[model samples]
Target: MEKFIGLVGTNSDNSTNRKLLQFMEKYFADKAQIEIIEIKDLPIFNKPEDKQIPEQVQLIADKIDAASGVIISTPEYDHAVPASLINALNWLSYGIFPFVDKAVMITGASYGTLGSSRAQLHLRQILDSPELKARIMPSSEFLLSHSLQAFDEEGRLNNGEHIEKLEGLFEDFLTFVKITNQLNHAHSINKKEAENFSWEEI
Candidate 1:
């Protein structure tokens, strides 16, 4: 089976975002192997002069680099993704280009009706940055609003409509990953550019 990384985009123990990823890991077990990667263990990014990542961050980066694709489930915080997710991305891009040209799918859940719309848009901009350059699955989004009640005791989404949409997007992502791998002719150049990238120069 194909392997994917379900990146939990928050550090909160009670995060619905984490629950969403867990649900995906199980619900999509037949289609792919989804390994849920957490960012809770990582510390804040300080942009160290040496450009060395924390041990845990490196381990997480390796998993992402090796994965066929990534699914990021985020929560809205101040109309944007949580600080923890930003911190994790910062560390991942400091010296490693694990996300370069990698297929990515953005999903978000929220207590409100917009379903983290703003946060998802912000994340898209971040992933499109020069250092990240993730090949995001476009024109598709899985937004789970009223997330607190979106799942049942079994941790599965209760809404048939939501499940239907999610299933379609997940299948789209699988195809997207295969198509993205074909666009890797410039992968080395992208990685080199990212490794030598600096904010001060731009």
Candidate 2:
């Protein structure tokens, strides 16, 4: 099956986080069809009781709905994930809940030694819910400390170990997606069976 990956980057232009996402794209070039979603294009989350959703928000929801899995490459801003990311999540959770039952993975990088750890933690918290099925890697495993020293001019991950780690994460994400999709299929089948069953005389 073709794996549909949605890459969400919090930057508008060239950024370390975007570079890292590009690297992942290269790694999964042939195996998956990757779609890049820019936070810059999205508007702030605004909820009104009787108002319709904006076209941009609907566009994002459609992308999330179409994707099989989501990979968020977030940057830390003042020791937290960007407001744009949070805003996007808020919009997604309001009515669409596009994240529900979706497989997700998060990787972060920064110039600081902590390497976006705080941001990743906050993201995990925000995304924590019964409906949002995510397979998050440990903080220790998904880090890019001193990212400026690690990547090349063409936005490639130079460290072989880091590349290997990312490849492993991608594999794990794919596995998780496959399992979840299969479970959904099984659930549908069971529901049909239950609904189609007829009453019998004892």
Candidate 3:
């Protein structure tokens, strides 16, 4: 089964973004496994301390490495991505590079009008950095604005339009993950073959 890591960008117990991720986990349960990764226990990134990676950080890194793709649910803070999320990415950037060539889909929920759109854009830039190099979904973004009223009492998204869009985006993202995995597998095989090639054999 294809596994996808869900990164919740907030530390709040009542975070709307967390709820959003939960919905996604259930929605995609049959298609792919979505494991929500908690960042609360991760220590702030430090260069010197990175030589001996923290156990929590290593554990999350291992999960990311094993997953076929990632989905991040973020909440905008002062028109920027949450510091907790950025800190987690910073840790991954140092030596892990778990995001390198990994397929990622970004979504967010906010009480504002833009639905964390600005924050998602900022996140895309960060993921595009040399160290991270994540491959994000190209066309659609799942943004839930006015999120307080977006969900029903049962915790499912109430807006039919939003649900339709999310379904489409998820389908596209799945295809993207499959294609990326195939390409990466082929690249690894080619690299191994080149490594074993000898001039005497040629």
Candidate 4:
């Protein structure tokens, strides 16, 4: 079965983004394994001092390294990704480099009309940087605006249109992950073949 890591951008226990991830876990349970990683336990990034990663951070890194894809649910804070999420990414980029060439899908929930759109854009830019090099899905954004009303008492999405869109996004993301993994495997094989080729004089 394909494994995917789910991360919530905020540290709040009651964050709507977290609920959104839970909903996704239930919605896609049969299709894939979605394991939610808690950001609350991660230490604030301190660069050189943090070279020796904490056990919790290493655990998350290991999961990401083993996963077929990653899904992030983020909330906008001051028009950007929450600090906790940024810090976690910083740690991953330092040495783990788990995001390199990995398939990623970004979504967000917010009280505002834009629904964390600005934060997701910023995150895409960060993931595209040389150090990270994450391959994020280019279409079918899953932003949830006015998030308070987006879900029902039972925690399922209230809007049928949004549910349809999310299902479509998940399907596309799975395809993207599979294709990307195959391409990477092929590239590695080709590189190994090229390296083993012997040149001879005719």
Candidate 5:
């Protein structure tokens, strides 16, 4: 089965975002292998003079670099992506590029009605940066509103419509991964450019 990295975009202990990815890991067990990665306890990013990548960060980068695709689940904080996710990405990108030309699916959970819409948009912009260059799945948005109640005791989605939507998006992502593989002729170029690109220099 094709493997995908599931990024829990928070360091919170009781994050619904983590729950969302966990649900996907089980729900899509028959179709794909989803490995959920946590971003907690990592030190904040400091521009290293030697450009050395941290061991944990390198491990995460390797997983993402080897995966078929990625699923990033985020929760809105102050109408933006949380700082923890940003910090993680900062570590993953500094002198190491794992997201270049990689297929990504973004999901977000919110307590309010908007369902982390702003955060998702912000994350999309971040991934679109030259240093990242992630090929995010187009025309797709999975928002889990009132996410605290969206799941059941068994961690399965309670709403039938939500399940149906997730199913369709999951299928689309699988196809997107396949298409991304075919479009990798430019991947090396992108990776080189990203590696050379530096946020601090710019």
Candidate 6:
């Protein structure tokens, strides 16, 4: 019953990041339910003492809360992620506390020499808030310089090695979700015993 959510950061219909997401969608199509989180319908976050949460923001939070894991895809602008993604996280981190303990992975595309390395690093820092349990792939590394030509003219990844890398990353991420879900299930079965089970025991 684990659900996977893909949070796409760019607002462009032809975004290269979105194309990457689409490739991911295909790769994970049979593994779990994948929900694409779009930024087009969201509004900027606002902190008001008397205002209620916006419907759009609440909708996003509800989805995030319901999903078991999330994949964050974005574009790097000025050495950081897009404003849309920042705003989305802002909404989730409002007094509502939407991202708590949510497993997350981030990926991006950039035209620069460094690719999206700086932007992804900044994203890792921002998402390290107390509410979220974001998990990133250290070895999967960055995909930037060749990202422009990595995809075929039809927008699909044409390189066999890159596709294999993505598949491996996806498998690893799914394993993470499975392990966490098992732990949660174990805790539910017997909270005390689950707590007592040592890491070596696991």
Task: Judging by lDDT, tell me the better candidate of 2 and 4.
Answer: 4
Ranking by TM-score: 1, 5, 4, 3, 2, 6
TM-score versus the correct structure, for each prediction:
0.98, 0.82, 0.89, 0.89, 0.97, 0.81
Cα deviation of 98, candidate 5, in Å: 0.4
* Model 3 lDDT tens row, 111-162: 9889999999999999987667788888668989999998888889999999
Tens digits of per-residue lDDT for model 2, 1-202 = 4556555657457668878877777768877877777777777767666546677877876887788877888778898998888877766665455665566788888888888888888888777743243444443347888988988777788899888888887787777777777656445444344334333521
Least lDDT summed over 10 consecutive residues: which range in candidate 4?
193-202
Q: For residue 32, give model 6's deviation from the true position in Å.
A: 2.3
Pairs in clash, predicted candidate 1: none
CA shift at 45, candidate 2, in angstroms?
1.8
Name the runs in model 2 displaced over 4 angstroms.
Answer: 130-141, 185-202
- CA lDDT of each prediction against the hidden true structure: 0.93, 0.71, 0.85, 0.86, 0.93, 0.71
Task: Give every collision pair in model 6.
Answer: none
* Residue-level lDDT tens digits of model 6 in 1-202: 4587788887777677777877787767888777887886677777666647788888887888788888888788888888888887777766555454556777777766666887888888887754343444445554645577878776678878777877788788788776655555333334333224344554
Ranking by lDDT: 5, 1, 4, 3, 2, 6
Best of the candidates, TM-score: 1
RMSD (CA, Å), candidate 3 to true, equals: 6.3
Better of 2 and 5 by TM-score: 5
Query: lDDT, candidate 6, residue 105?
Result: 72
Candidate 3 regions exceeding 4 Å error are 185-202
